[model samples]
Target: MVLLLRQRGRLTADTLARELEVSTRTVLRDIEALSSAGVPVYAERGRHGGFALLPGFQTELTGLNHEEALAVLTAGSRRGERVFGLGSALASAVRKVVDALPEGHRATASDAAQRLLIEPETDLLSRRPVTEEVPDTTMIEVRRAVLAGHRLRIHYAATGQPPQWRTVDPIGLVTVRDRGYLLARRSGEDRTYRLSRMLAAEELPEPAQRPNQVDLDQVWRERCAQFLSSDHIAVLVRVHPARREDLLSTAVAVRAEEPDADGWLRLEVTYQDLWHAEWALWQLGTSAEALTPQSLRTSLHHRATAVATRYGHQPESRHLLPS
Candidate 1:
């Protein structure tokens, strides 16, 4: 399962044998085993295709207790909120797990889970950790809209935006970490709405056609990849011995090198965009420096000045003398 997931494209009998450290005949037998176990294992006798699991073949979690079920749903919910593709799958799996929970503990556990208050770890740079619990009815409604290809008229609030009513064609429900999001199309744009921020949702009377313009999963993957790709402003930072963990925790797709004699570690990470990069540098306090992209240093210095001015003060005059 790990190999199938980690590897992309096609696989040959010999390739699978080498990867699994078994004979070619053994690889064929294992493929048969997967097939018999209802895995969509198929082989195409061509250069482009070989042994493969059918696309969208995933094990459903339908056998777990209330707490255990909640864990699975919550895990997927958080990740889906970040990457839109996994929302529908997570919702379906969560539903199955919820349905399978023992009757006596189901309702009580579900209610308790909904009321649970979670605090997001401040160490990461991903989307705000979804720690707030949304109502169960919202999840049900979102799922119904997604599966039935219905439009939803919802009142939603974005992080820095005012709340407003919008008509969205529900594509999938993404739950990242502690929050669920509705991935939908507005106008022609793909928009993600936090489930907790959705004040109200109702199925619209005017059922619209599901657009054939873009694949939701593909769009989600592209967005994530684009967001995490290394920035042009390659940065290196010396962490305060005390706050090294805090800095390391915020690096999403960065390479961190061993600390030098000074109690500071060097890291290689990209800024998603200028705004994101500036925000990250602020979080590092005096521990970070731009190893490249000289402009970032100037920008950070300017930002510091602006922020300090806000308090009727000037920034400290200790700019890292141009290295």
Candidate 2:
């Protein structure tokens, strides 16, 4: 019973019955046993109140050292996807566990939480809400496999391929720019698979081993730094504040800086990957101007020329812009 309380701040009779390997009737009997034996368990008759500890009941967790308390609190707060109900319940349960910990651990716990703040620079959901429904069960299963460090047998369909079943060891789950990805190690190869294309996944019993062959974070950082230091050209944009908000909200770039109170924002960005930036700029339309890097201006002009050629000559006497 005490262990159950520590694991979950509150347990209902049905939960206690399941945990104790007894029926609900037996659980009630046991409660009576504890009560008769001078324990202060109180069972309320109303809908909201079940069995609750008497008002002044005390426990050892209330005396934790700073580090210990912070560890508990930080773990609870780290459940960031609690945009739904489960996250809230999980967070609430974690808080109770932290609250129960001894006071000596509070400072250490707080410091750890501060040091480990994992704020994502970009969130896929922040751009807008998604109406497409993904099965909650599928998300749960994927999370379970990730937590266990196990390989999963998945049926996946890529854009140009038929659905096929493959075994993969998931390394990370990323939600970037309105898309969720499962970063996984492909079986029999050095490459990784993305989860969004997964059709189905079944967890295998065997655990996937982490490779000592690569320092993962260092590798990613090196790649990014290499791009920043390389011979790649930079592009500049002059943006109005209203447009700046849209750019900041949608674009992934190295730097965004506001130049003055004139509501003009200057951006210094590199296009390491070219597939998406042009489409993004087109979406921004007239609000954005390519300010510098004359090569880009030439390219844009050529593109505009090609577009006008495709549409034939404009009406000779009609002005396009409004008077």
Candidate 3:
């Protein structure tokens, strides 16, 4: 109740009751309780008026415990405030988290947060991370539809396809590795689209067709299972320990792996297609060997032979390093 008042500036009795799923009497009781508890809550009498806090009024984290305050502070700091195009709101939340802490512990909490690091600029091999950019307008509209239970229309350009108009029942938004995606339903069929692929968006007045409540995390996992199981080309390869991550990173899934007597690791992994498998293994050169799929081996052999001929040098044994 207090949070709604603080964020919305003013909310009527009906608004508060509806938002909290409580009676007007309960809201009034809470308002009285807040005032009695030394909060600067006030009620204005008029059609355009409602309960509001005093200008510049601040409150301790009423609903959140002290530990939760620290967690918010840490998360906000780590995400750098600008996550999923909500930088300003996240910045405000972080400030609120800092202010909510006890006077003596605020600085200490901030210092503790600085010591933790996630998703560094580069890995052991100095490879950079991927960060996809979504236009601000597209994100704003998509978020509005998802939050307000409205249908969303988007101009999307999927991979290898021209842009098209799509109206969907927006279920939720997800961000992984800084890449944003919209999980929605189109024509009663599940669909997922990258936020960066949205050229434009509009929030429709009609309500979304999804459930009033949903287990968004569970839905995401189910969709991921379907996506990974579709037409994925499985491959078996032996990779040098030094480039294990290089091979694993490109593959969609790793089903099994073990170390051979020669100290190389044999991995059963899946890629998007045969071309993708061949291209990834070929990049490892002699440090990796594809053990299955004669097509992949033949493709790599031809490429290696062509490279050797261009340099007027005899290619080494076809099986990569000697067994």
Of 1 and 2, the candidate ahead on TM-score is: 2
Worst 10 residues of 3 by lDDT: 74-83
Q: Per-residue lDDT for 215-241 in model 3, tens only?
A: 988998898778878998878899999
Candidate 2 displacement at residue 207 in angstroms:
5.1
Measured on C-alpha atoms, candidate 2 has an lDDT of 0.60
TM-score for each predicted model, relative to the true structure: 0.44, 0.52, 0.67
Candidate 1 ranges with C-alpha deviation above 4 Å: 1-130, 159-161, 205-208, 211-217, 225-245, 248-279, 282-287, 299-323
TM value for model 2: 0.52
For model 3 the local lDDT of residue 223 reads 84
Error of 3 at 98 (Å): 1.2
Show model 3 residue runs off by greater than 4 Å.
Answer: 1-83, 253-264, 309-323
Which of 1 and 3 is the better model by TM-score? 3
Tell me how candidate 3 scores on lDDT: 0.81
How do all the candidates rank in terms of lDDT, highest first? 3, 1, 2
lDDT of 1 by residue, 50-142 (tens): 777666555544454543343455453444332333333444445565555665676777788789754555545554543665555565566
| Per-model tally of clashing residue pairs | 8, 19, 0
Each prediction's RMSD over C-alphas, in Å, is: 19.8, 9.0, 13.2
Compose the digit string of candidate 2's lDDT tens values, residues 104-218. Answer: 6844675676687454544454644442233555566676676678877778887799999877776655443334556566754443344456667787889875453445455
